[model samples]
Target: MKKIELGELLGQMTVSEKVGQLLQLAPMFYKGTITEGEITGPMAEMGITTEVSENAGSVLGSTTASEMIAIQEAYLKTNRLGIPLIFMADVVHGYKTIFPIPLAIGATWDVELAEKMAAISAKEATAAGLQVTFSPMVDLVRDPRWGRVMESTGEDPHLNSAMAASFVRGYQGNPDELAENHEKMAACVKHFAAYGAAEAGREYNTVDMSMRELYQNYLPAYTAALEAGSKLVMTAFNVVDGVPATGNEWLMRDVLRDELGFDGVLISDWGAVKEIINHGTAANSVEAADVALRAGVDIEMMTTCYLENLERLIADGALPVGLLDEAVMRILELKRDVGLFEDPYRGLKGDVDRQQDILSVEHREVAREIAADAMVLLKNDGDLLPLGATGRKMALVGPLATTQDVLGAWSWLGDMKDAVSIEDGMKAQFDQVDVAGAMDTENVTEAEIAEMVRVAQDADVIVLALGESANRSGEANSIATIRLPETQYPMIDAIRALGKPVVTVLFNGRPLDLHGLIEASDALVEAWFPGTEAGNAVADILSGRVNPNGKLPMSFPYTTGQIPVYYNHLRTGRPADAADAQEHYVSQYIDIPNQPLFDFGFGLSYTTFAYSNLELSSDTITKMDTLTISVTVKNTGTIAGKEIVALYVQDIVGKVSRPCKELKRFTKIDLAPGEAVVVTFNLTEEDLRYYKPNLDFTSDPGDFNVFIGTHLQAAFCLA
Candidate 1:
C-alpha cells in the first residue's frame, strides 16, 4: 500500500469511521458469544456505540485462532474497503514456552540469547494469532521497589540499549519477518520516556527528571529499539515533567518522533488517553483526546476517549483533520506491511504448530540454555556449589520448591501446568530428594517445618528455594520494602541450624535485601524466575554441567535503605575516602557501609580469571583520535569458564560533574584453564560524549582514567 493509496483509503472513511480507526479495543468487543449488553459494557458508558466496536482498527488480548479469524471475517463482510484488524497482545517473554523474565534475561548479558528468546516468543505468539507484542520494555531502573523491574532489563543504559536492540531484531527479524513470510510479529517498545523513574519507585507515580537526565540515561534504550526497527512505541501512563506522557507534545512529538526518528505507530498504554484528564492536564475526555491526538499518539488503547471525542474535536477545530487522516493511514499501512490484508489468518496455524513444533523439543533446549545462562552466582563461599546430585541426597525447601510458578509475571499466555518445578528438576538428577515449603504461608505450618527439618537433616545437602511470588512483581505491584517474606524466616532459620550444606536458589523478580541469608547459606544463586525449563536450568548450575557465567545488570543493595545503589554514582564532594577512615565529618553512613552488597557487572563463576597489564594506546585523545585499551585475562582455575571483561571510563575534568565510572564496552569470552586472552576496546570520540553543562550532546576533551577489569574478579595482576 503506497502513501497516497493509504491516504485515499483514509479519505474514504467517514468521521465516525476515522474515529473508529483510532480505537483499539479488547477481545470482549469482538468475541461472538459475548452478550450485547456485556459487549456494550464499558464502551456504552463511555458513549461509544457497538458500531465503533465493529469498526475498530485493532484488537488486543486474544488467544484463540478460530475466534480471531471469525471476528475478522465478520468485520470484513460489512466493511467497505475490506481492511484487516491487527491483533496485538502482551507477549513479554514467551508465548507458550516461557523464558526467563526480562530482568533475568538482563542477568545473562547474552545479546544472542536475548534475541533468540524474542524470536521464539514472536513465533509462538504469531502462531497463536497475534500480529504484535508489547515487549522489550527498555526502561532503565535503579530502585527495586518497582514491581515492573521484572519487566525491565536493568539500571544501566548501555546494557538496556543493547538488550532492546537485540529484542527488536529478534521479534521483527532481520530483513523484516513480515516481508519474509509473516511468521514474526511487529515489536512494540514500551513505556516510552523514563517510566521506570516513577517517584519513590511507585507504580503510576509522577516521573520528574531533568532533560539532561532524560537524554543521557533514560532515552537511549527507546532510541536503540527504534533504530533496530521496532514497528511501534507505547506511551507511558505516568506524567513526565508535570505533563502526562500520553498528552505531552514535547515528549511524544518533539523527543520521540523528531529527536529519536521514530516514524512508526505511537500508541497509548491501556486507558492512558482517558487518564490524561486525571493528571489535571486535560479537563475531560474531549480535551484528553485533543491533547493526545495533537501530541502524536496514533492509537487509543482500551479506551473510548478517542472514539467518542475525535470527531467532536475535529468539528470544533480543536484537532486538524489531516492529523486524524495521518493516524488512520499509518494503521492501514502497518496492516498492509504485516501482510494482514493479504491474509488475515497469517500466523493462525498454532493449533497444529503446538502439536508439532511450537513448544517442541528444540524450543525447550533453547529455553534450557537461556535459563542456565540467566542464573547468577551471588555467593559461593568455600566453593560449595557444583555439588553433584547423585553422590548425596539433597532436600529442596521453600515456597517455590515444587510449584510451577517459575514463570514470572507478564506471561499471561503461558500455562503454569507446563512449567517444571524445582522438586521435579532435582529428582531427575539426584537419587534421593526431599521437598518442603509452599507457595503460600497458609500451607507452611509449624508441623510442616518439623517434618521438613527431620527429612533435611538426613540429607547430605539442602537446596533452598526462596524469593517473591509472581503476583508480587510486574505492573502496578510496586512494594515499599524488598525483603524476603517474614513467614519464610522460621523455615530458613531451621534449615540453617541443620549443619548441612545449605544452598539457596532465589526466584524473585527484583534484587532483594539478602543481608540475613548472605551468611546463613554456603552458596546463593540468584535465579529470577527462569521459565518453562526452570528446574533443569538451575539443576544444570547445581551440577557441574554448566559453569555460572551470568553478571548482575543492576547492583544488589545491602538493605532497602541503600535502595538506589549502583556502580556508576557520581563522586561525592566530601568523599568517605577523601579523609581518614575514622573521620566523623566524611560523607559516610553511620550504621551501614556506603557500598552495594554486590556491584553492577559483578558475578562469580566456578573458575577464576586473572586480569593483568591494563594498557592504553594513549593517555588522551582529540576529536579525530581513537583511543585503544587492552587487558590480558587468564583463566587461573582448573575448569573452563566465561569471563565478562568490562571497560569503564572516568572523565577527570569536565564542565559538568560526571559519574565516577561509566560502562563503555564489555565482552563475555570463554577461556580454558591456564589460557589467556587479550581483550581490546576501541574508543572513538563518540564514546566519551555526555550531556554537557550547556546541554550539548557532545564529548568534551579531557584526560580520562581507563579502568579495565575481568568481571571485577581481578584486583589486578599488575606484573
Candidate 2:
C-alpha cells in the first residue's frame, strides 16, 4: 500500500486497534490460540486480552520459517485491519551459522569482511522467516567492564561508524533491492544514543555525559547507520541527560529525528518503555506511555505501557491523534517497505533450502576468513608463531582449548556442537598435539598438574589457551574485575615455569586485564570468540596458513581501576607525558604507569612494516581545501601481510581542547615482502571539525599533527 492508502487504513482503525499494532509480544499468543487466552508466560502480567493478543503488530525472538508462517497465517485471520504481523529477531553476531563477535570483527579492521558477515546473517535470517533484525549496535564503548562491549564494534567513533554503515549496507542492501529481496532485511541500529556509556560500567545504570562528549564520540555511529539507510532505531535503556533514552525528547526527536534526519520507525529496547517508570521519569504505566509517545518512540517493544495506556493518553489530550497516526504509519510503511503487504510471506512460505543456507559452505568460508583476519598476535618474539619448524610437538593446554562455545554472546541460535575448538584446529595441522585440563578446577590436583607439566616438558613448545567463558561478556554480565579466573592465571604461570616456550591463545569478548598473561607467555594471540569456524581460523594463523593482521579496537587497561581508557582522550594541561612519570602535580598514578597494556590500533604481525617519506599535497589547508596526505609503507619482513594504515589528526590549537589524537581516516592495504605502496588519505574540512566550547561545530585553522601507520611516531606537521 502507498502512503495515502496506508493513512486511510490507519484512519479506519480505532484507537485500541492502533495501539495494538504498536504492541510487540512474544510466542505466547500463538502457543495455542487467542481462544486459549493463555496469559501464562511474560505476557500474563501484561494484562493481554484476546483482542490484543491477536492484534500484536510483531513477534520477537521467533525465527523458524514454519513457526513464523503459522503465526502470520493465524494472525491475519483475526487482525482487524488485515495488517500482517512483522517478524523481528536478534541476528546480532550471527544466526545459526555464527561468525566472530562484533569485537572480533572490529579487531579485523576489515569493513568488507564485516559487511559480508552481516550480509550472510541477513540472508540466513530472511530465509528463516525474519523480516527485521536488531543488529549493528553502534554504541561507542570504551569500558570492557560493560559486558555488552562484545556487541559494540569498538571504542573509536570512526571505526564504529564505518562498521555500522557497512552493516546497514549489507543488511538492507540498496533501497531498490531491500523491498523485494527476502535475503535482504530491515536493519535496526540500536540501543540508540549512548547506551554503552553506562556509568561505573554497570548494566542498566544511568549514563551522564556532556553534550560535547555525546556529539563528538557517541552519536557518530548511530548517525552513520541511519544515514546508511537503516530502517529502525532501538531506544536505549539508560538515561541521557537525566531522562531515559526511550522517553527523552531531546534524544528521540531532536537528535535522532531532526538532526539525524531519521524518519524511519523508532523502537524501544526490550521492556524499555515500561522501565521509564523505574527511571523515575514517569509515575505509572499511563505516564510512561504518555512520556514515551511524547518523546516520539513509535513501537513499544515487550511492554504493556502503550498497550494499556496510549488510548487513554489520547483521551486525556496528552497525545495528539496525528502523532499516533504518524507512528502507526511509520510502522506500517516499514512492513510495506519490506514487501510484507505485497506478499505477506516475502517469498519464504514456499520451498526453501533452510539448512543449506544457514550453514552453507560459502558462508563458512567467509566466517573462516573473518576469523583468520581478526586474530591479533599480541606478542611474537623470535618468530615463535607459525609453528613452521619441522618436527614440532605442541602441548595444547588451558581452559578454552576444547570448548566449542566460541560463538560469543547474543548468538541465541548458534549451535555449540557445530563449533570447532583450538584443539581440533591444532590437531588438523600438527603431528603431536597433547590436550590437558581445559576447565579450571577448585584445586589443581597434584596429579593433573604433574600430567600437564610432563606434557609441557615433553613438547617442543607449549600452546596454552585461556579466557572468560562464552557467557562472560554480553548484556547484564558486567564485571568489576576482568582478570582471568583465579586458577587460570596460576595455570599459565605454572606452565611458564616449565621453561618451555609457552604460547597463550586468549579467547575472550572484552579487552581483558592481561598484565599477568602478557608477562607469562612468550607469544600471545587475542582470539576473541571466533564463531563456528573458530578452530580452523585460528589454525590458519597459527599454522602459518594465514598471517595475523588484527589490531586492538579497544585499549587494554593495565588494571580494572584504569577503566574507560581510550586512545582518543583529550589532552590535559599537565599530561602524564612519561610512561612512569608519577608526580604529585601531574596527572599520573602512583602505583603503576599511566598507560594501557595494549594500546588501541596496536597489533603485531609476522611481517613487519616500515613507514617513511611522508608527503602531503599542501602543508597549508583551509576550510575550502582538501589535503592529500600520502605515506610510503613497505613490508620490511620476510612475509607478506595486510597492514591497517591509520590517519590520526591532532588539532594543535582549537576553540576547545580536543583529543590528543583522533582517528579521522584509515584503510587496510596488503604489501608483499619488501614491497612498498604510497597509502594516501584525504583530510577534508569535516575531518577537522569538532564541538566548540559554545557547542557550535567549527575548526580553528592552526598547526596540526598528523600521524600515519600503526607505529605512528613519524608525525608530520600541517598548517
Candidate 3:
C-alpha cells in the first residue's frame, strides 16, 4: 500500500499488464455473463483480446456492491500482480434516492445544502461499491440550448467555483484520510477547460475562445476543485485550440498539470481517446494512443487504443517506455490511495444489504426539503400562491400532472416509479382535487384539450403542470428553440379560456423562453424536475408549508435568437441605453430588447424584502485595504422568508476589457416579518483581480461601482 510496495508491484507487471492497467473497460468484460460469440463480437470490434479484459485496471459501472465484490475477487485471482480494479460511475446528482438536478441545486444558492446532497450521493454510491464518481461538473455556461448546461452550476465563475469546492469537500472528505473514509469517494471534476463554451450550444461541438477568456471565465472552477483536493480530472470531448482535449499536450500538461498543479489521475471521457482520430488529430488508433499518452491522459476509458497499441508503440521506440510507466504508476498510486490494495473490496465486503442504505426514509426527507428550497417562484401575480385553506376546487392538468418522470437526467440508479406525482401530493393536501393528465408534449389532440377543459371547468383553480420530458435535456439532447413544445400551447390556451386562476409548474432542465406560458398563467413556478419527493415538495410550497426561496442561476432569454444571454457582459463603446431607445445608432436589436426576460439571481419569495442604508466603510482605499460594504435588508411582507443577497463589482478600467458587472460574493439569510439585519461583505483587492492580456491575474486601481441585490449601489476608488 505504500510507495515502495506500489513500485514493487509495478516492477512485477509485464508490458501487456502495464498497458492493461491504463485501459478501463465495462463490467460485462469481467462478468463473463455473455456468450463467446457476444464477447468476441465486441472484442474484435474494439481490437482487444480477452486477456486485456482480464487484467484491466478499472470497471466503468458495476450495478451493485455484490457485483463489484465479485468482479474484484475474480480479477485479483488472475491478475499476476493482484492489483484491485477500481469501480467508477457517473453518480452525478444522487444514486437511488434522487435529488433535484444540479441546475435546480444551483437555484437554491445554498452551497451547504449542495454539499450535504453530495455527501448523501456519496453515501449511496459507496454502498453500491463505487470508489470514484465523475461528478461536480463545474463547466460555466451562458447558453441555455446546451443540454449539459443542467450539469453545470451556472454562468458565474464565483458560484461555480464555490459549489465545485463544496462538492469536492463533501465527496472526498479529508484528502489525507480519504482512503479510510469508506462513506466518501474520490471526486472527479470533469470535462476540463471550457467545455460549456461549445459552439452553437451543440453537444460535442468545437470550442474556440481567447486565452484571456479561458483563464478569466472558464478555468477557475476546475482550479478550485483541484485545490479542494479532487483525486481525478476527466478530459473534455471538445477540442481546445484545434486539438482534442484528450490529445492536447499543452492543455493537459502545460495548463491543467503544470499551471493548475493537478498531479492526480487524468482520465478521458467515454471513448474520447479513440475519437481523437475522428477529430483529425491522429491518423489511426496507434497514433491516437501515442497522442493521448503524450497529452498525459492516465486512463483511456471504454477504448481499445491504449490496450491495442501502447505496447507496440513502446516496442517500436516511437514512444517513451517511461510514459507507460508513469501512467501505470499513477494508476497504482490511486489504487493504493483508495485503500484498494489494503482492503481490495472497500465498501463491498460480505453481508451487503443495499436496501438499508440505498433509499431510506431519511434520505427521501432530505431530498424533499432540498427540492422545496430549489423551487423558484418566477411569477406570483395577485398573490395566488400559498393556496392555503381556501377550500377551493382544484384541478391538475397537462402532461406532467400525474407523471413520475420528475427525476432528471444522470439519475441512472433512480427509478421513475419511485417518484411522487403531483396528483398524489395535491390529493394529500386538498379534499377535492380533479386530474386530466396529458402525457404527450408534442402531440395533443382536440379531444384531449376538451377532456382537460371539461375536468377543470368546474374547478376554481387550475394547477397546470407542463414541461419538456426528461429525455429532452441532458447530454446529447440540445434543442433549437428554448420554449415550451408547441403542442402544449393548445392546452394552455384551453385552460386559460376556462376563466380560472391558473398556476403553472414547469419541470424543465434549462431556463425557458416563457412567452405564452407566462401570459396564460396567473402564477408560475420553475420546479426543474424535482426528484423522489417531487410532488410532495411542490405541494409543500403551494400549501404554504414551505416558502419559495430559490433564485435563477442562468438568465432566461427573451427568445431563442438570444441564445447566449447572460448578466455579466462587457460594456461596449456604444452600449444601448434603455433611457434613450430612440437613439438607435448603437448596438440594439430592432425587434427585441437586448435584455433577458429574467436576469441572473432573479427569484421571488412569498415575502418581500427591502434594502436600505447602503454604507461603505471608506469611499477610497488602497490596494492593501479591505473595504467593508453593508446594507440593511428587512422582511417587509407579513411572513418569514429567506433572501439571497448578492454582491457584484465592476472594474472601471483594466489592461483588458472587463464585464460590466461580475458577481464576487453572495449569502443567503433568513428573516422574519419586521426583522431587519445588516448584511456585510468585505471586498479586497484580490477579489477585483482578473486575467490580463498576458495571462496575469491582478487588479487595476481605479474607480469601481459595487451593487448589493442589483439596486443598492455605491462608488469607491482604489488609490
Clashes of each: 0, 1, 0
Best by lDDT: 3
TM-score of 1: 0.96
Candidate 2 structure quality by residue, lDDT tens digits, 1-719: 78888979988989888888888887666543334544555456678777787777888888688788887888888877789889899999788889999998999888998999999999899888898999999999998999999998899999999999999999989855777787999999999889899998899999999999999899999888988999999999999999999999988898899999999999999999989999999999998988898899989988898888888878988789788888988999999899988988888756766646888888889999999999899999888988863588889877677878788899888899988888888888788888885544234455666677777888889988778888888999999998876767667778889889988888888998887788888899999999999999888888888989999899999999988799988888777774555667788888977889889999999988989878878778777888888888999999989999999888887878888888888999998999999888888777888898777887776788888844553333334
Candidate 3 lands at a TM-score of: 0.98
* Candidate numbers, best lDDT first, in rank order: 3, 2, 1
Stretch of 10 with least lDDT, candidate 1? 710-719
Deviating ranges (above 4 Å) for candidate 2: 31-42, 352-354, 440-450, 578-583, 710-719
Question: Which order, best to worst by TM-score?
Answer: 3, 2, 1
lDDT of 2: 0.86
lDDT of each: 0.84, 0.86, 0.90
Model 3 misplacement above 4 A = 32-38, 350-354, 578-582
How does residue 189 of candidate 2 score in lDDT? 94
Question: Residue by residue across 21-45, what tens digits does model 3's lDDT show?
Answer: 8888887777434455666777777
